[model samples]
Target chain A: MFQGYTAAELTSIFAMQGFAGLSLFSVFVLMALGLAIIFGQMGVINMAHGEFMILGAYVTYLTSNFFSEHLSSMFSLYFFVAMILAFIAAALLGALVEWVLIRHLYRRPLDTLLATWGLSLILQQGYRTIFGAREVGVTLPDWLMGSYAITDMIEVPVNGLFVMCLTILITIGVYLVMQKSRLGKQTRAVVQNRAMAGAVGINTEKVDRFTFALGCGIAGIAGSAFTMIGSTGPTAGQLYIVDTFLVVVFGGASNLLGTVASAFTISQAQSTMEFFLSGSMAKVLTLLTVVGILMLRPQGLFTLKIRS
Target chain B: MKKLQDFTRNPDAVSFAVLAIVLVFILPTVLEIFRLNLVGKYLTYAYVAIGLVLSWGLGGILSLGQGVFFGLGGYCLAMFLKLEASSPENTAIQSTPGIPDFMDWNQLTALPWFWEPFHSFGFTLFAVIAVPVIFALIIGVAMFKRRVGGVYFAIITQAIAAIMTILIIGQQGYTGGVNGITDLRTLHGWDIRTDEAKYFFYYLNVALLFLVLLVACWITKSKLGRILVAMREREDRVRFSGYDVSNFKIFVFCVAAAFSAIGGAMFTLQVGFMSPSFVGIVPSIEMVIFAAVGGRHSIIGVVYGTLLVNWAKTTFSESFPELWLFAMGALFIGVVMAFPNGLAGLYTSYVKPLIGSIRPLLKERARLYETPDKGGPDMLNRGTAQ
Candidate 1:
């Protein structure tokens, strides 16, 4: 397939596709981070994880609009404000959902999947009702619009760079919270042994809610990042839910580093193949490979030896 | 007469009898052909729901890609019908005559190799069931042998569904793309677009649904069914007891796939088209909800559940399109949280006792009338006791 390209052209193509893959990796990492905390750390499969992300996206959209209307002078910085608002909005909803829907289905992971799917449907419709079923794009500020040439051949878009930086920052924050902080320690304790954690003075339910909310907040930031590269629709969130879940699963659920590594591998493989093959064919190949690998190694790329 | 008596003595006999009467006799009499045909389309989904009841409900294998099998079955039959519909006389204007119209449009001069066997009616019918079962066999062997069950199994199946849809939509020339195989006019020289054909297909679909239901009931009632329930509860114990649990899981998954394929084939015949829309993650999960709503444990309940859900969907979507999703979402949550047993559970918990109470009272009254002096207050006491 690459026989026609000169060596110089091939290098350039690789660089371009690799960059595209990196942007995709950034999105996958963001989405999977939220899912990993909720699904991996908390054992809750929020099928509405994508919806929570969309909630973030929609929040960004509204914030962008509000800035353009009422505070055009501070338009370039509106994205930061949008990201924060998206986090808070998604976190608050996550807390509410955890309280009302997820807490009861702690024992039945399968039931939680179905119930969250239902919740996703309601959220999708709610978005449609408000957003008029149209795909909405956030107006990019001039500062975030252009691309920088790394060479004559390799050019990188500013927004892609921004998203990657955001992903890095958020990933670090999550890692620090989960690995270093007291709350993270408590959350991990709850996950390892709910009864034991509760017996030892940890409020397991409160930890569960906070963990879920934090996960959802990360997803909101992902959605906010998503608006920079792509258009958002009511159903757009659903398109990524399956892939995000796969990323989390392939990373060996409970392992944070595994999620990031799997996301990188998947996104890179997909984007590179997409350059060589048709888009759908590339996706089919990537997913088939993931599924194949998963069958062979059901515990995923990284395994945490936690005895049941 | 002996068989009838035996059947009546069966625990599910009343539910089965009532369903049979309503579906076979009452529905046809009550509904117009259009509505009857809609019921037939909905019954095709009932097949998938029934399959879910076996795989997910009984066997504890929740496959989220039943739609792939369903699509495979539908496409096999649709290919055969498309070929029959696109005879040389039917496509003389095209540059490549006799091949499917979509293929000719894509500049293909000959039928694709996979589509060639579908030219035969027998091959097509056999392939409808065989293809999906074989595919399911492969997937089941791969995942189940590795002991990948629960949510992991579900996510993988869902990925397969996504792959199936993307493949179907991408291979436009070969698979008819997103529009799917359409304008299917006949089956074995009989024009299927006619009112009589619709009625014929409806009855055929209903009969097949019953046959599938009976087979499922047989599986669920046998010792195998008991093992399945045990496996669902504790898979390790079942394995420890000398059963190759993976083999059973594979078997039931394949059976579920076969059932969904039959439903898909019928759906193609009834709807006159097969598309990627029916072969995707959404529809596959929706099929699970159909089984769940009907009472995953109840064979007969899922059929009614499918009908009710589809009926509500059609009516609600037609009237208040926006509210339909909300209603469906609530249904999913409500069924899981408040009514985990679904309609059958509700029926057993509430309706059955009411019926039970009524039956004894009527029986006691009749006995009292027959022997007024002897039966006196004892019959009343017996009725109250029941």
Candidate 2:
């Protein structure tokens, strides 16, 4: 595939594609982080995880609109406010969903899948009703719009760089939250043994609700970052749900670091393949490889040596 | 005659016979030809639901990629039909006279090698069933043998569905691209587009459905069915009992794939086209909904569920496009949360009791006149029956 390119050209091509893959990795890690918590830590298949992300995107959209209209002087700073509101909105709904629906389905993971799918449909329709079916683009502030040129042939967008940095920060934040915090300790206790946790005076139900909300809050942040790279739409979430799930599953569901690693590998492979093959073909190959690998190694790429 | 008597003795068989009569004889006679054809399309989905009743409801294997089998079956049959329709004389104006128009449009001068086998009706018929079963076997053996199942199996299957759809759409020249294989006109020199052919195909589809239903019933009633139920409840217990659980899972998965493939072939015949739209994640999940809503364990209920859901979808989407999604969403949530066993469960728990009480009252009334003297013996017989 690279036979026609000179050595210098190939280097530039690799560099540019590598950067593109980095941005994709950012999105995948951001999306898969939340899923790892929900599906891996909690064993709850939140199929509507994508919809929660979309909620964040829409929130960012609305925030941008509000800032442009009302707070013109601080338009560049609106993104920070939008991200916080998005997290709160998504977290609140996530808590409600956990209480009303997910609590009843803790034992039946597959049923949780179907119920969340239904929830996704409801959310998608709700989005369409409120925002119209058309795709909405958030107006980027001037500071975030341009690209960084690295030599004659390699240029990377500033927004992409920003998303990557944000992904790193969030990833580190989530790791700390899962490993070090009091809520994290309680959540781990609940996941390890719900009955034991409850007996030991930990509020397992409350921990579950909060854990779910935390996962959803991360998804909302992912969605906010998503607006910088792509237009948001009612159905855009559907497009990425399977891919995000694959990243989580391929990474070893409960392993946060594994999620990041798998997302990086998948995104890099897909982006590089896209340079040589058709976009659809690239996606098909990447997903097929992931699924095939999973069939052989169902525990995924990484696993902790803990007894069931 | 003894076999028939034994079948009649089975309650499920008896209910199935009633359903078969209504679908095969009554429905066709009453509904217009177009509506009947629509019913046939819905019945095609019933095939997938029936398969789910076995693989998922019975065997504890939830395959989200049933559409892969369904699409493969449809595409196999459609390839043959397209080949026949694109004969040299029929397509004399095209650059590639004998090849399908899509291939010609894509500037292909010769038919693809894989497409050649589809030219023969016998080969196509074999391929329709074999292809999906073989595909299912590959997937089933790979996953089940490794003890990968439950949500993992569902996710893997979903990924396969996504891959298959993308492949079909990408390889446009060989697979007919996004538009799919269309304009299917004749089947072995017989005009399939005609009204008479539609009626014939509908009956043929119903017959195939019954055959599949009987096979499913046999599987469910056999000792294997008991083992399946056991495995579903507690896999370790079943395994400790010396059953090769993966083998049974693979068998049921293959059977479901075959059933779905047959339905897909029938769908192509009745609908006169096969497309990638039916072979994706959304449609595959929707097929699961049909099974879920119909009481996944009951074959008859699933068929009814498919028809009812599709009918409601058609009516709602036609009249109020926006509301249809909400209704569908509610149906999914309601079925999963409120009525886990679905419509059939509702029938058994609520409706059957009402009927049981009413039937005894009617019997008591009858006993008052004709069988007043024999009431004690009749009550004894009823007690024995219960």
Please give each candidate's TM-score.
0.97, 0.96
lDDT for each residue of candidate 1 in A1-308, tens digit (9 for 90 to 100): 88989999988888898887877888899999999999998778899999999999999999999999999999999999999999999999999999999999999999999999999999999999999899999999999998989998899988888889889988999999999999999999998888999999999889999999999999999999999878999999999999999999999998999999999999989998999999999999999999889989999999888678
DockQ of each: 0.88, 0.84
Compared with the true structure, what per-residue lDDT tens digits does model 1 show for residues B93-119? 999889999999888889888888988
lDDT of 1 at A239: 95
Error of 2 at B263 (Å): 0.5
- Can you list the residue pairs that collide in candidate 2? none
Full-model lDDT for every candidate: 0.93, 0.93
Q: Report the Cα lDDT for candidate 2.
A: 0.93
Q: What is the two-chain DockQ of model 1?
A: 0.88
Which docking class does model 1 fall in?
high
- After TM-score superposition, what is the CA distance of residue A133 in candidate 2 from its true location, in Å? 0.8
